[model samples]
Target: MKSWSVVTDHREWHQGDLALPSDPRAWYQLGAVGGWQVVVADTPRTVAHDIVTARTTGRAGQTAAWCSLPFAVPVLCTLATGTGVAALQTAVKAASAEGLPLHRAVVALTVIGEGRLPPLVRAAATMLQSQVSAVVTVPFDPHIRAHGLAQAERLGRRTAETGASLATAVLSAAHRAWGDPLPPASVPAAVSAPAHAVV
Candidate 1:
């Protein structure tokens, strides 16, 4: 069975298969009634102009367990947006019109870079990193094409190139932060499981 995410209006933040209370205007605060201390700000990539950061002190699922030289990754999750929700609702309506189940309707959009998936993904990462200082958003390049689907694809791809770009970026960030182990000359040569993509 597929897993569906539940978001409680402006009280919680959730993004998965099927969002509960599929109201397009349902905005979540990213941090909810949990042990997490969420503080929303601007994107992490723009610390030069403005600074938005979030951190987890454990007791929550938002901590980016740092790998030191492998990027200061916090517990990564997808972001949602008004546009993304509208697109999702459009898909849902189409599915409903076709007499398909909610999952069946939503599956078509889950494919990365297809239809509304990218916007939703981008929105999610932006919102997350904006809130938590430790989080980040990987803007995938056309050539690199980071992992957009399942962990199975990220791990089992023969080329092992799915999340290579993101991993490379993380490793580079790690190098910058620690300044050791020299840095990767190439992506394929450097990217590896467990060490590369933290997902």
Candidate 2:
């Protein structure tokens, strides 16, 4: 799988108009802003490894392939399958460890098979549950039947916004998880009070 940029444009709330080259690795062109472009070299590992790993283990991969992207920019994390929830989790963990804060990054996982979407979304929510700012899942597989290219185009378009949103939300959640002042909205609802609770 080779990487290439796909031509596009980014409109940020604060950064104003920006041009994204029609190349996949042009993600960095986003610079230190709230928007960008991400064209992933499709691969099965996205579904095979990331999803299975995250679901099985309580963590994900933090290798070079996953970490090379400019975390500072809103990232469009594309996969051949919508199964890289673990990668996303690993990213959050890495950000926390690096003291970078999750709210500063936006992450989107695109899966080719519509059937696999539900599980992927669930896994992401699981990762984000303990923090504020709900995780967003933009499903485009359903749009494949009518227009396959159209679906891909939509995926590219949504990546910009979702990337920005995820960045902000994750950063917020990361701070809350780490005991900062920011409240984490993504935290799962608490169940069963402590036994030591006063009667």
Candidate 3:
């Protein structure tokens, strides 16, 4: 994501115009007021290992093949497939420790956890969730309570909002005894309690 300028309205979203790059890969760019990097791993062990190495080395972590793109002390965006929120929690701790101020650690736990969604919508779910989460949870640079809800209002297309399509992406385990590839779909509509539930 180049610079998440400020999502003015939903009209801009459907148009995929928000002062951001049109590159679809930009959709995978997730994080805070500044910028962030995606840390995708197949296992929690690997994820934890990578996080640790990054923390100790004071360098951003990347997959064996990926080149770490550190954008101004970027926050970490994690997507792991092996287990629970333990790894995510670790990220939160790391960010907090490093004074990220507004770091995020989200994941699609299990597909079964999120009822179900059609394939295409299911696929779009993660992208939307990441965008929404990062936008809503901004830097304490401003009063969090004051600016939080407004962020959602501006990006939610309804400035161009996609309802159920914006639900959490839950997954069980991809390469497990009882697993699939990733989560089903749907992001958390509300930061705390949602006004309407998504399936």
Candidate 4:
């Protein structure tokens, strides 16, 4: 059996320099937030390296987390666009080489107006389905949060049977994939009531 760990790029708001989450739950929560890209890996070192590299390429103060699951379960690589398909494939290949299972591969699209899953996103999910245990879609549009949340909920329910899931503001796809327990009620809600209902 394999153990899990997490390395996060998030920092608390304070007067001093940045601070990382000392607890795995904190890392999980940060990754669960909307608009952030999440990638899970079988090996901690590789995932950490990838996340660090990815973050360095972007702007500063960009928060992220590298979580290790409780078991040597499947990896859930959550990407944002079509451009990330190649990276997903590479990560899958690497995990296979290391004999680590992949749970799900999710591609989050930040587009408005949704009916069925987009063809390109569908193609990517289909392509990775064989490599991973499942493939999921997260429809997200910051401008229209409610619609995206509704679409995500529908997709999550539709794909639940196949071991796939959706990403929402209240409940993220990463947390669902990781099987992380729900946060305490004392914790503040991430989204409004209408949006929360969708997840």
Identify the leading candidate in terms of TM-score: 4
Give the alpha carbon lDDT tens digit for every residue of 28-101 in model 1.
Answer: 12222321222221122211111112212222111111111122232222324445445534433443343332
Candidate 2 regions exceeding 4 Å error are: 1-73, 76-83, 116-121, 129-134, 142-199
lDDT of 4 at 53: 62
lDDT of 1: 0.31
| Model 4 poorest 10 in a row by lDDT | 59-68
Query: What are the per-residue Cα lDDT tens digits for candidate 2 across 1-199?
Result: 7345554333333555454343323433332132322323322233234434654676643222333443322333544243456666665664555444344344555555445456556666666645314545655545444444533555455555655676556556445444565332232234696678567
**Backbone clash numbers for all candidates listed:** 8, 26, 19, 3
Roughly what TM-score does model 2 have, to 2 decimal places? 0.35
**Candidate 3 per-residue C-alpha lDDT over 47-123 given as tens digits, one digit per residue, 9 for 90 to 100:** 44655687789776542212222212122333332232345555455544544422222333222222343454344
Candidate 1 local lDDT, residue 147: 34
Off by over 4 Å in 3: 1-47, 63-83, 99-106, 112-199
Error of 1 at 63 (Å): 3.3
The C-alpha stretches of model 1 lying farther than 4 A from their native spots are 1-72, 79-113, 116-160, 180-199
lDDT for position 99 in model 4: 42
Model 1 weakest 10-residue run by lDDT? 60-69
Per-model C-alpha RMSD: 19.7, 18.4, 20.3, 14.8
User: Per-prediction TM-score, please?
Assistant: 0.26, 0.35, 0.26, 0.38
The positional error of residue 168 in candidate 2, measured at the CA in angstroms, is 11
For model 4, residues 1-199, the per-residue Cα lDDT tens digits are 5333444333332334444444455544554552233424222234434544655676321112322433223344444455556566666665554444344433333334446655765687787766654454544334234332234345444344333333342134336554677433232246755645545
